[model samples]
Structures are given as structure tokens and as C-alpha cells.
Target: MLINDGLVRARGVRYATASRFAKPEPLAWDGARPSERGPACPQPPSALAALVGNSVEGLSFDERCQVLSVTAPADASGLPVMVWFHGGAYVTGSGESTKYEASLLASEGVVVVSVSYRLGVFGYLRDNLGLLDQLTALRWVRDNITAFGGDPANVTAFGQSAGGDSVYALMLVDTENLFHRAILQSAPLGTRSPERAEMTAALRSSISVDESTSVEDALAAQTAAVTEVGPKFPPSGGMPFAPVLDDVDLTAAASRVELLVGHTADDGSPYVPSREHWEAVTELIFAGGARELARDWAAACGQVATYTFRWAPADAPLGSCHCMELPFLFDPDGWRGAGMLAGQEPDPVLAGTMRSLWAGFARNGMDALPSRSLEFGG
Candidate 1:
């Protein structure tokens, strides 16, 4: 019932085929087919949605999202692998988010795997199940990426926002060669990661809804409870959903790998008290935290590179706010969903620079890399 042409054939100088290599669901089954995009982890509407013209509302979200997509150049073998994680404050986003497209990056001679993991109450309400989900996905890539013409040995991970925090988690966890390098963009590392009991207490104390709360009602109430507080959320009482430092698996060796970390200039504006507060937060949360991680890695293993993105469109009211660099790094043409953060059109020169830097890191392992890490607003 099968034909050779259907199994393996090409058009336009490239041939591609995909399969659901693993079924991570509770109900495991084999012979998974590659047909459609996986569901995104569910989440409430983002507040930034209003400011960004509700463009973020229409994309996609669902529960069955613990999957990954790999794209590679044709005629490729032993190519490095770059797995990507998108950011939505541990609540929103998926590997399918328009911002994490892997085509452009894969075109540069590496296998690009965009991963989706659990989020929100499904992830961190009790323990770090979402993080565990990410670990599982990474393990899958480590074991099977070679089938896609990728080099299992030269795996690299890159993430942004909450995704960036996940990358940092890889450094603290016992990765054991799961990946050889990482890139963290706009990671909120300074945010406090409390111990397990403390974090659980924060969640318990934040919302009062009992079992009677419908799934949708509970999700709404929980989102309101956490966001009602001022910009710097998960306030004084507890942290509803953040990584617990104490739960780190100490038995596994601490990860040592070349790292690249960065944040945009106005990263804190929409989340801080005033313009002045935003500036202070940028110093404390982004710059200071990057320096600490860099110094620690400098002492531990391979070299570290850090950058600050100061480029903002002339008319941008919020300046180079959180995740402003994503469009430049991913797809400038398809980044309209980014709204005001990326402006009408992004800077091509800056895009080329970032593309080169990231691809080089994915290839060369930080032994030799560019240094103009900071890009002042043009």
C-alpha cells in the first residue's frame, strides 16, 4: 500500500518528511503522524493585548502542546541542533508562536527545533511540572534529533522571557550534555525564585476559589488575583507561579556550557512604577542579573557573552520594551503581531547582525564570537 515516491521524494531541491516520534500524553500510542501543528498550552488573554491592539488574541492556544518541530537544510548531516522556547511569563505562548519560526534559522545550516511545553496552573501550580515537561522534550531531542540530520552532540538551546528563565534553569539543573550551549533573551533572572514550600504557600494564599470553581472560572480568578497587584506581581505574600530553587536536582551535575544572555533597554517600563522606576529595574533586574550569571559561568566552564538592546523606534512610546528584540531575531516581515514593540518595520542591519551572532554561537560554541553586544537605538 506504500509507494517509494510517497516515502521519499523531492521537489524544489528539498525533501522533507515528519512523524510524531513520541506520544507524551497519558495515553501512549505509537505510529504518530505528522499532519498539523500541536495545540498551544492554554492561557488567559494577556493584558498587553489591549495595548498591542489585541493582535495577540487570535493566534492559537490549547492543552496538548508538549511537542517540538524540527527544520533543517537539505543535504545536511551532522549539523548542530538549536532548540527554541518561547516566553509568556510561564502562562502563555507555544513553539508555534509566530515569533519562534525556525525556517530562517534552519536555513543557516542547523537543525532548528521549536518546542512547546505545559504552562500556567498546568505547569507550576504545585511542583515544577512544566519545567519537567521541558526537560522531557529536551531529552527527546537529545535522543532523536540525529534522525533529522542533526548532530546529537552539539545541541544548543535558546529561549526568551519566561523561556529565557527556563534556559537558565538548564544551567542550574543536571543537564548532563543535554545541550552544549544556551542563549537567553530578556530573561527575568532577578525575579525571586523561592523554595518549594514557600512558592506553594504563595499560590495557596493568592486565590480563594475552591473545587467548585469551574475550570474557566478558576483560571479567570487565578489570573485576576495574580495581576491585580501592581506591576511587580506575585507580591509580598507569595509567588503563585515561578521556579523553586530548592527543588533543583542536586544529584545531577550542574550544567556547564557557553552562554549568551541579553535584555532590551526599556525592559521594565510597562511593569515598573515610573520611567525612573523602569530605569532602576533595568539596572537591577536585567543588567545586574546578567553580570552575575556571566561571572558564575566564566568561573565554571566555557566563555559567556552578554548584551543590552537599546534600539527603539523613534515613535515607540515604551522604547525598547520587553521582547523587542524578537522580531529582529526571528522574522522581521512576519512580526506584525509584535505591534508597537517592533514598530512598522524593523532595522535590517541589526537583524543581520543578530542572525549572524546567534548562528555563529550555534556552530562555533562561543570559542570565537562577535563583541558589539550592545546596539544603541538607531
Candidate 2:
């Protein structure tokens, strides 16, 4: 997307543009429609990718990988937008992954924009640059989404895992009307981020590339392999990269935004080794954290609702583990490659239910139907 909205930021105006991303020149456009998937940022090997043989997890890395995709109905205008940030523990994955082909969601009425941002050291270590990238994208959506037939006033920022953390960050950072709704899906909200120095030292020790390998290449490789299922991830067995909480940002007046936050019934099932405290793990790490955030927001701003996704595919050993509900929620047809979600229970009827709920929130600022612990039994 060509940046046609830079100058507006220099003025005292907090917003960047009426639309952040402009239609690219012919050669610059990657495909017929912006919704066609684009390149992913650099990341290392992922155990998740290895499991499903999903190339997206290990797609070739590119530094200039800030492209985004938008899916919208051909006849629609002034539609609500759902801006998605893909999850990969702050180090892996991309919005370009086919697992996020939001066409069906857009087909239901609203527009969907899946975005890409810098990961690992390029984004977090030297500085909090990844989040800066995200902020820039959100600002772009605010200014340019209208061109894509989206309503700037009715936007919902949502994501799962690391992306969910980013949605939380946006809630904390965006006081200037960027998005009116926020959805946090299976985010490790309570896991404290490790120090950059510690993470760097860990990477420096774990990496064993060829002697001639550049420092950046080694770091990137290590970062990719060091994900949740990887041996070196969580740096020292906990989350590594995170937004440094500025007392100013954390303590900002509560966002004037509604919240729809939730987690899988067993978010920690895959990440945590033992099933003994899996329930506790979910509560301590994701669900409980969201509750605290919701209570805090409800007191400070608008309405808040929380639900647990309890659906399970028959092949799933652990019920509703991390990201197991995503395929049904975003793209049931393209969800196959993610390994975490199998085709066991993804019927069109189920997908339609999820679509109805998500679309309702995006359009109306509240859930059309209250979702308790929703169960998609196999």
C-alpha cells in the first residue's frame, strides 16, 4: 500500500490520515485485489509449521514486509471493519498466512483487513518498533479504510495470542478514536515479558549457525525456532518479547471502547507440558488476565463481555487448545494447514454461527447474542 497519509501526522493532529493505505501504483500492486495474500516478515522455523507442513510459518523472510490485505464485499460500502493482527508469540506467523483468508467473513457484509508487521529484534529488542509498526497500521486504517468501503468510525481491532496482546496494547494506546471495539483471543495477558538483554543473551547462546552467518541471520533463525513449542522460546521458559509497560500508557484513562475478550477452554493445553494444572494455567495466563482487564475497562469505559471457546475437534487431545477455534471463526475452508485445527467438526453451520456473532459485534458494538462457554462438540 502506498503511504498517502504521512504529512497529517506532523501537525498537532493525533491521527495520520483519513485513509492510511492508498491503492498502489500498477506495478506496486501484488495482485488484482488487495485482499490477495502478501509477503510475510522474516521468522525462523516453527514447530507449529513443522506439524502441519504449513509453508507460511516458515515463509521466506523479507525486511520490507509491511504489506496488508483487505477483503470486502463488492457491493458493500460504509461497512464496519475488522483489523486483524496474526499471532505467533511476537516472533513468528504473519497476517499473510492463508489460515487467515477472511473472504468468508467479508462475504457476510463487513470488511476485513489482515495486516503484517515487523517481528523479533526488528520490532522489539533494540526498540519497541513492532508496536510502532502496528500503531502506524492502525492509524492508516483510520485514514484510508474508507477507500476500501469500510467505516472509520466503526472498527474492531482483534487478534489471537501475540496479536491479542497487540489488541490490548491498542486499547491502552489509542485514545484518539482509532477503533471503537476490541477483541482479545487467547492472549497471554498475564505472562510478563522478559528483558531484551536476557532474550538477546539467550539467543546468542542457543544459536549455532555456520561460522560465516551474519549476526542478524543467526538471531532471526533462533527467533523462529524459539517459539512456544521450540526448545529456546519464552527465552527462559516464559514469554520473551512484549511491550514495555509505560506507567503512562498502562495508566492512561481507560479507553472509551467496548471489549469482547475470551480464551479457549484450554489455552495452555499445547504450551504447558502437564495437563494437571491446565485449567489453572488458562486462568492465570489468559482467561483470568482478560477478566482483570475487562473489570478494569468496565469500570473505566463501556460494556465488557467475556466467554470461553470450548469447542473441540475429535482429533484434538486437549479440548479447545490454543487457536483451535480460529478456523471456525475466521476461515473454515482455509483453516486446514494450521494442524491445531482439524476438519473434524468445522461444518458450515458452525462457521456461520461464529460469523454471525463476530459480524454482529463489528456492526453493532455489542454481541447480538450472549455467548456463554460455547461448545462445538464433535
Candidate 3:
């Protein structure tokens, strides 16, 4: 399992199993060592494929995609663990995507675990199965990550976009303290979960599909449902498959976890066709939402930190847009096909600084922060 740069990788490790539309059950030992990256949850093409490259290209898909990948230094012991949940509006993207390979972060002296959960109708149509899948994965890590040299108690749950939202959501439900710190990048809080009545109506649109339906028919039904319901939730309504909002006290849960959350300078740029529209979207959705969360967390607890990544490749049209910071956190080469990078790799010094800051946070929580608010590039 040892790979380049002295890192040991355990790919396609099954953490849990679930039947269609059911909550996941944790699996401690599957009787077989995982060697290949498991299939991603079946999903349609990403809406952001033109911005970030199509991550699912050439990747396999299945309903049973509750797997995680681990990468750690060959000699690692008791290292801080950073568990990643990829972002694709909770519809697409997988932890096994090359764009998410953790060699760079692993080389930075921490253990990284990338997770893949169910997506789309299979995950969110009638139940919060995907989020439950994440909780199940966390439980698996708590019970077994020690074998991979990660400190179960020193875990940092971090993600971007929907994945970032997933991390923020996890803070409210992680009553067992599975992770002590969180990093949320470009989480679109402006599009909060719809009211239960609204969600119920939306779910009704896909009532024709069920556990026995063919995957193609299910996906078609999901698309039809979203098309019918999207207009009701304007602006960010294009995203309907979201975490179901719970009755937890946001202030209390956010206060307990050390948090570092923020968005890119142009996070909404990729969604709009022009600079003006993009600017408006960025402020209304990404920037404003993250700033509001940071303010609320700071008022409730003193352990919150925030940041803004403003760096973009020179002349890049999507300047510092969503997913821009990912190249710095992982291997830039992995994102070579992404249009957002403009054929330019992330600056090495900046990438190093970002990685160090992230790894340090995993190691020491908010105390590792250089400041309460930080700006990178531009």
C-alpha cells in the first residue's frame, strides 16, 4: 500500500453498508483488505464540469459507494487526521477522484482520509441517508483509524462546497466528539435547507421511483422532480439535494467546535456568465454566508477563525472562483485539466503556506491559526 513520496495508502476501504434508501451500518472488519478504489455513487454529470474538470470521467459508479481512502506518511504515528468530504452540490464528485488524491497533504505530515457517500435520489430523496453515511464513516474512523496511525481523538473534518456544508452540518450532530475541529471552504449557506413542508412536496415529485426502480429511471425521475421544484426556491434553488435541517441549536453546536470557515474571493463566478452577475452572486451567497457564520461563531465562542483565498492564475476568467483553493491543498497537477486554473499550477509558496496552516489546525485546532481572519493571494 506504500506509494510515492513515502506515503502509505489504503484505497476503497469499506466503512459501512446500507440498503437502498436506508441508513448506513458501520463495518469494522470486512474480511478483505481493500486494494482498489471503490465505485462512486451513481450520479449524472456535474453542473460545474466547465469550471472544474469533470471529476467522474472514467470512474465507475454504483449504489454501494460507502467507501473511504486513507493516506498517511509511511512512518506516521498518532498524527492528526483530516477527513475530507468532496463537493459537487451533494450530487456528483467522489473521494476517489484523482483531483482529490491526498499525496500532497499526506506529504505535509498528517493523515488524510477522503470519503465517498451516496448521492442524489439514492441519498436524499426521502431520507438523510448520505449524512448518515458520513456519521457511520466517522464512527468507523473512531474505532479503527488507530491501525493507520491516525489519532482518533484529534480528527479534523473538512470539505469544500457541499462537502464543506457537510462538515458544518456534522458539527451539530457529532455529539460523540468524533472530530474536534472543522474547516469549511465555500459552503453555500445562503441556500439553507428548505422547510419540511417544502421538502415533502419536492420528495413527492419523485414518488414514482423506488428501491426496485432501475438506476436510469430513478435518475430520470430525480431530474424531473428537481426541474419541477427548482423554480420554487429561486437563486440557489438549483441545488435541492441538501442536508435536512435539524432542530439543534446552531449557536451551541458551532460554539463547541473550533472552526475555520470562509470562501474564495470569486466563489460564485463560475455560476454566472458575466463578471457583474458573478460578483453579485459571490456576495449574496458565498461571501456573505461565510462572513455571517464567522460572526455568529465568534460571538458565541472565541475559538473561531476565518480566511479568504483570493489567488487565481494570471488572467484566469474565474478569478479565485469556487474550488480554486483545492489545488493548493492537494497536488496541483491533479487539477491540470480544470479550466479554473488556466493551465497554471498553484504557486508553490502559497500552496505550502495553505497546507501548513491546514495541517497545523488539524494538529492544534484554533491555536494553530495565524490570525482570526487571513487573506491569501491577490
**Ten contiguous residues minimizing lDDT sum, candidate 2:** 7-16
Please write out the lDDT profile of model 2 over residues 1-378, one tens digit for every residue: 222212000101111111111211112222223213456666665545633336374344565456667767665589999988988877778877777877678777888877777666545553456676677777777777776678999998999988998888777777677888888898888774344345555654555554365647756565554552234433233556666555433334354677888888888777656777777788778888888877776766657777777777676666678877687777665566555655464667877887878888889866564653344534
- Sort by lDDT, top down from the best: 3, 2, 1
Residue pairs in clash, model 2: 17-143, 18-143, 18-144, 19-143, 19-144, 20-140, 20-144, 44-224, 123-130
Error of 1 at 219 (Å): 0.9
Reference-based lDDT, residue 127, model 2: 44
Which parts of model 3 have CA positions greater than 4 angstroms off? 30-33, 193-200
Residue pairs of candidate 1 with colliding backbone atoms: 40-62
Candidate achieving the largest TM-score: 3
Error of 2 at 288 (Å): 1.6
lDDT of 3 by residue, 60-84 (tens): 8889999999999888899999999
Clashes of each: 1, 9, 0
lDDT of each: 0.65, 0.66, 0.85
Alpha carbon lDDT of residue 181, candidate 2? 82
Each candidate's TM vs. the true structure? Answer: 0.82, 0.79, 0.96
